[model samples]
Target: MTYFRSMLPMTSEEMVFEAVRKCLDDAGLDAGDVDAVVCGSAPDAFDGYHHKGLVAVEPSGAFAKPFSRVFVGGGTGVGVTISGWWHIASGLFDKVLVVAWEKMSHPYPHAQPLFRSIFEPILEQPLGPNLIWIFALEMRRYMERHRLDKELIARVAVKNKANAMDHPYAQLGAKITVDDVLKSPVLVWPVHRLDISPTSDGAVALLFASEHEAKKITDTPVWVDGVGACLDSQYWTNRDLSYPYYVYLAAQQAYKMAGITNPLKEIDVFEPYDPFTYKELHHLDALLGKPGLAPQLLKEGQLERDGDHPTSPSGGLLGVGNPIAAAGLMKVAELYWQLSGRAGKRQVPNAYVGVAQAWGDLMQVGQVVVCRA
Candidate 1:
């Protein structure tokens, strides 16, 4: 799950095919049973390919089948699930192969310049912006608004990486302290070098099926109860960073569709995208339909692997390694195993309902999926 020197030798397409093959083998299905193929990849710039989907399809088992690729910045992981839902929901297909992979190692070490290149040349490019720079500004804003200490904010990184020690597929899993985070050099004021998820090369695959086919495929099937996605304006400077408005709206849409009035009590586990430590808190506040709950809850040990609400129980991107497109899908897969009581060492108790969320595009897009066992 983590990136290493050996992984860089393989191409992105090869990674996709290998993961998909494993998926097929585990599910007792073959390529012929696949009604369609859905490719989940990050931006073209990351892989250094213009048409990554078409480039990845033949090796991805979509040689002559109905094929489509979904990319929504970092949310492409969960976006793959949302895209595959349509094929099954529309009654046009019984099975869909959803594959998510990212080769972030291509532009390793200093990906900031590549990140800066994606901004609008006329407006934002003039500022020499990178995601870390922008994230630090938001982090400072959130801290100032809450009048909180930096030590409290740094707890997220410590907790996630520590929890990753139990994750079999973790990259940076280890026992670290809050002091370690404080001693880390400040990359941009509030953001520390250790507080960010490392860029990784990884892939994940999931098979989606209609209700009828799901029953026949496996005795235990995790159902997609609700799904919601929202895109907000690109006015990053104009809006307040204290909360993510679009993320809240997306969670609301999902909760409403799932017919659950109370999320904290109803949903047993949560896996929110956390490319940055502060991002875990930002997304949690929005997902919970409130502000400033994450820090306080975290201090009380409520966000732990055995707490009332377990956030990022699978170590998330912070610990398990962030291969963007594959990260969110890995969360969904974790929820499936958790709810089924098959997560092995990291399983939560009685996790019947769960939610996994992803954010992308200059903090403008929110994608959510509510699942049940």
Candidate 2:
């Protein structure tokens, strides 16, 4: 994976090549060994290009091979891996290369304006709504429903950013205080600047192999135990913003497939997407199969790297950076590293099972992947 940053001095193809090359090199395999490829990216406008799949083919090592692109807003990262899982799971491919990249830096001024296109043109676009304003509404509802204090939510940013201090690819790692988060500029009520992750440019790649080939690739192959995805009502107004039922449904589907009835105890590590401070808590609660339970766990420091049931030890999108799809794929990569004992300084002790989740598309889509050592 490439380092998460605001402006990478490389083209989109260069970024993809670096990540896919590193992944293939690590796996000790060549592009010829891969039977198929999947490219995960979001919005052509963000990169100022169309037919992004075609642009990604060569750099992703998909020349003359089965290749496809996936876009599920922020969920594209994990979505691509899921796509690869099925490629091998369905007995259609032996080895699959999954690549996720985003270049938000190419857009002039800022990439935030591009999100305006995501909303319903006739209904929502007239209001000129952006992610921040909509997220503010969700944050407010979550806080009120849980009766959570701003300080509690601020601790997420504090914990994730501090955890990122050990991550080499992290962009915003720092030892900050809750007061620092509270003092930052508030773009919308209940949503501080520090609470939001930065727009970034980066890429991440992963290789999926069948059990037969995986055993040959590496004895310590991290198994993709379970995968699940769900999309809620597209109109954000139709659902209860206080909680994410879509995430819960997706987690349930994954947990059942993984034979995990008790997530808090069975899952050792978690890497839920955290584009915003509250989102980590929001998704965590849903992933745990217990709504409104994450706050207590957070207060007790269970979400810390050294704590029981450690979460986002990779610093998550909040600290590591949010390159849209790449950030989500980064979570899955973090799970592979953690479960395989390759996470180095950020390793969670005794971690055998881990869950990585990402939410996208009008706060409606939820994608989850579970891995085990």
Candidate 3:
């Protein structure tokens, strides 16, 4: 028997419901067949609402069912999916439904100000820093140490947006260039408006079934061969900004579970969190346990869709729009599509296994999933 998985976009509760309906339709199953539901999202401040899990229950078909909600900032979506997979793999449930959503547009002062709360209020806030500041600082450090130019960073934006052109749920799609990114209004030093993912309102749903149920439903079931999640101390000031220690730890755990001794050679594709261009490179280094290769890959155009190891083939958060929790789930969805041979034109050639990772909340949390066709 094998395990099966599916994913759909999250626009609203209604849209989420419709996507779940489609997933059930595609799987030839119904809401009654599900054993449990796991929902995830970021803080209420970003959504301008509280108890979002309750609001999602009825629409997501979790009503009257065993349901749970988990939050870990941007890692919430992957955290929920990992939870759902565990429920089925633990001999408790045969099927699980995972839902992740974010409505950043609902907030009054925009989501930017709300993210400031994630930092240490006494120290970081007094310094007049926001989320972009951290990313900008990370970008600056990466460029200075690695000798990368702004043009290379802009290429990430261009490639991701171009990839988004084929994504049905993509929010920003354009034939952009490096010049477009450099010329875009600067939000923070070294971080331009185009470098950031927009505040979006969306959700994504995924269905996972146990080996017994999966084999009965489809001949080719994408296996959840590996999953790893870890958190570092919330004290951001104590950590090194040059590299993400949490991401490395999480990758080490997931790679071991997947029996992958060499990630660069064994893994077919990658979907690292690209909330910022530097993040893609940051995660790649952590995932591979070597930061030195990233610059070479970028210089040789190996990180593009047509490259040796395609990263962010779904355009990632940068191109697809960042709906927080939903963005991570979207990367998982891309892995599912690629593994199932349904990615259409965006498909990576002969991709047998893919790794999707999400880093969240001051680079303190890391979630990694390894899926196989």
Q: Report the error of model 2 at residue 204, Å.
A: 0.3
Model 1 compared with the native: what TM-score? Answer: 0.96
Report the C-alpha lDDT of model 1 over 1-373, residue by residue, as the tens digit.
2232214568987788787888888779998889999988888788878887776687668888999999888888888888998789999999999988888877656455788866778988898777687888888888887777878877888878977778876888878888998899988888898889888888888889999998988888898888899988877876778888888998998899898788888999999999888889889988888788877888898999898889998888889888888988888888888887888888888889999999887778899999999
Model 3 residue runs over 4 Å out of place are 1-12
| Local lDDT at 367 for model 2 | 98
Pairs clashing within candidate 3: 10-203
Query: Which has the greatest lDDT?
Result: 2
lDDT of 3 at 190: 94
In model 2, state the lDDT of residue 279.
Answer: 94
Q: After superposition, how far is residue 249 of candidate 2 from its true place, in Å?
A: 0.6
Candidate 1 Cα RMSD (Å): 1.7
In model 2, where is the ten-residue run with the lowest total lDDT? 48-57
Better of 2 and 3 by lDDT: 2
lDDT of 3 by residue, 1-373 (tens): 0001112233357656765677777788888888888988888776556677777787678889999988888888688878888898899999888888777766665667877777787767888777888889888888887788888878888988898888877888678989999999999989999988877777787889999899998887889989999888888767767778788888888889989989989988899888887788888888888875776787789888889988898888888878788788888988999898888889889899999998787778899999999
Q: Which residue pairs overlap in candidate 2's backbone?
A: none
Candidate 3, residue 348: the lDDT equals: 88
C-alpha lDDT of candidate 3 relative to the true structure: 0.81
Task: Name the regions of candidate 1 deviating beyond 4 angstroms.
Answer: 1-7
The sequence of per-residue lDDT tens digits that candidate 2 reaches over residues 257-351 is 99999999899999999999999999999998787999889999989999997989999999999999999999999999999999999999998
